[model samples]
Target: MNDLGRIEDLPADYVEEMRKVNLVPLWPSLRGVLPPLKPKPQTRATMWAYADIKPLLLKAGELTPIEKAERRVLVLANPGHGLDKMQASPAMYLGMQLLLPGEWAPSHRHTPNAVRMIVEGEGAYTTVDGEKCPMSRGDLILTPTGLWHEHGHDGTDAVVWLDVLDLPLVYYMEASYHINGERQPIKPDRGDRAYAGGGMVPTPIFERSHKAYPMLRYPWDEARSALLRLGQDRQDLDCIQITYVNPETGNDAENILGFYALMLRPGQTLRLPARSPSCVFHVIEGGADVKIDEQSFALTEADTCCSPGYTPVTLHNRHADKPTFVFMADESPLHRKLGVYEVRN
Candidate 1:
């Protein structure tokens, strides 16, 4: 129709003139009546905050070798809730994970991105792809995009960690796969300790890894003592949100993944910087009212929350006399790589 209409004369009916031709790239123009191309309504998917929140507790006796600590996971954006499945996007899949003493989550691997923030525990380690990193409370471990990994609690104290994966993101894409290795968990050999950290030497960068950081572990202890020390001064450096960095260069570990810890002192409320990459956080220690887009929601240890990539989010320590801590993860780095990650600020 566009061609015929554009021409001075047509030999056949307007509809008949178009029937013999195949659709082209500009199909919308076929009708000859310009259908104005409007930007898809600027919509940020639905955000599930407070109200219908239910946090489950994974109890001790119920755990098996495959799981420990009476594993409890609170589903936030799930297909069951009249919402899209969590695996559709990389920013989703926020689960609170806990493991009791003597329990182990044996070896396994998958195609989705995953990370764990030690909520509480003394000795537990997640061997990623093949590298083993010691798991201590507040530690951050990265299982970038498609690495295989497993968790084991070898310490005398119970171990708890929040497992945040791109499950919902993968679910949406339907690009998910998993493999279970033998149940045995072993420390990485000295030469193969790349997953834990040896800097760039351990990172697999074969072009494909471009825009994707594969380092698997980000420990919280590294930031813990420093936070405590800074707490003494309690000045401008308050609420240090140190992005999980490449241990060797001291540069923000430019992995496709990102993780951080927030230290909240009593009465202190941290206003999350605008353009936060759709943060996913698990309460590691203490409880507080986390304000997202100005709405306050109470969160305690083991509870998880998800914020859209570009929105206002805040963390306020409600505990009058205690310090509250949390671990946050996001795929903003990856999005930045794709040239699609942006903040409103």
Candidate 2:
């Protein structure tokens, strides 16, 4: 092109002077580091259909024994992360874990904060330290950082759940540690626990100085009821949102992550433009349309959608009669640390 002739004709001394100052001409550097417009997220929006994955999960259980497998999980790996690792986005890790009846995943602990959103089969449970938290179809169970925990299926059928972890952040900080060994169970107090009706009797034996919440399970029944009540109170038809909080500190459910339950009424929509901290959403019930920039993905029950940090998004419930419900988790720790978390109007 004619523009290229100017560079070829430049005097040698002029180019040498530019090199000596540790500067390159603006053209190349700016294109890579500072683009003309906000770039789309490196990660792509994805969906994992439970119906398709369930049979595969059962087959995996038949092939591998629990002790040898450590954990039998099918990671919802993002295409952007390449094939080397299982990452839902640059900031999160998502997988579906399966356990056969009478099997157990031995107790262990790691630095990454983790959560379990039960996908199917119940009566299976996760024990954090000593508290027994029974798993259900829509429950959100937490296995906070460095806390010894184990999963076992005592139910008649196979148990499966979506396992989410803030591993990317932990690994990024080089704070990763793992104890892939058995842990002794602590006998939980029968009376004093977050699940024990609001009277909250003190259970000193269960207390850890740094621990935020005493409850392991945030039951779906309570969450759904609360959402319904809030929806009735609000005049807006778009969405009713609630966050799981640490009863002690009144903040997010965990120190490193944030959790939300949203209910979008039929024909309503929520437009959330680009902001800091990436988010991954799990559809709890009904169907909705999730738009990421110009691309769109339709999500149904048990499907998941990912949006990397600073990517514009809009969620719509196009169902003619029923409401759509979703559970969302995000990298809140990074957001809080950088002081850049927000929702663009």
Best by TM-score: 2
Tens digit of per-residue lDDT, candidate 2, span 19-46: 8998656653444555544544567767
TM-score of each prediction:
0.66, 0.84
Candidate 1, residues 1-345, lDDT tens digits: the string is 234333324344654656658523344444444533311211233333322332233442353334433234544554323344433124556654555566667666777777777666587777765567788776777776655666777778666566667665566578888877775445444222443433345444324334245445655655666666667676776666556765444544534556777788887888866563567666777887877665567887656666655577778887889788777777777677778766664
Q: What is the C-alpha RMSD of each candidate to the true structure, in Å?
A: 7.7, 4.6
Local distance difference test, each candidate: 0.60, 0.79
lDDT of 1 at 340: 70
Best by lDDT: 2
Candidate 1 TM-score to native: 0.66
Off by over 4 Å in 2: 1-40, 190-210
lDDT of 2: 0.79
Clash pairs of candidate 2? Answer: none
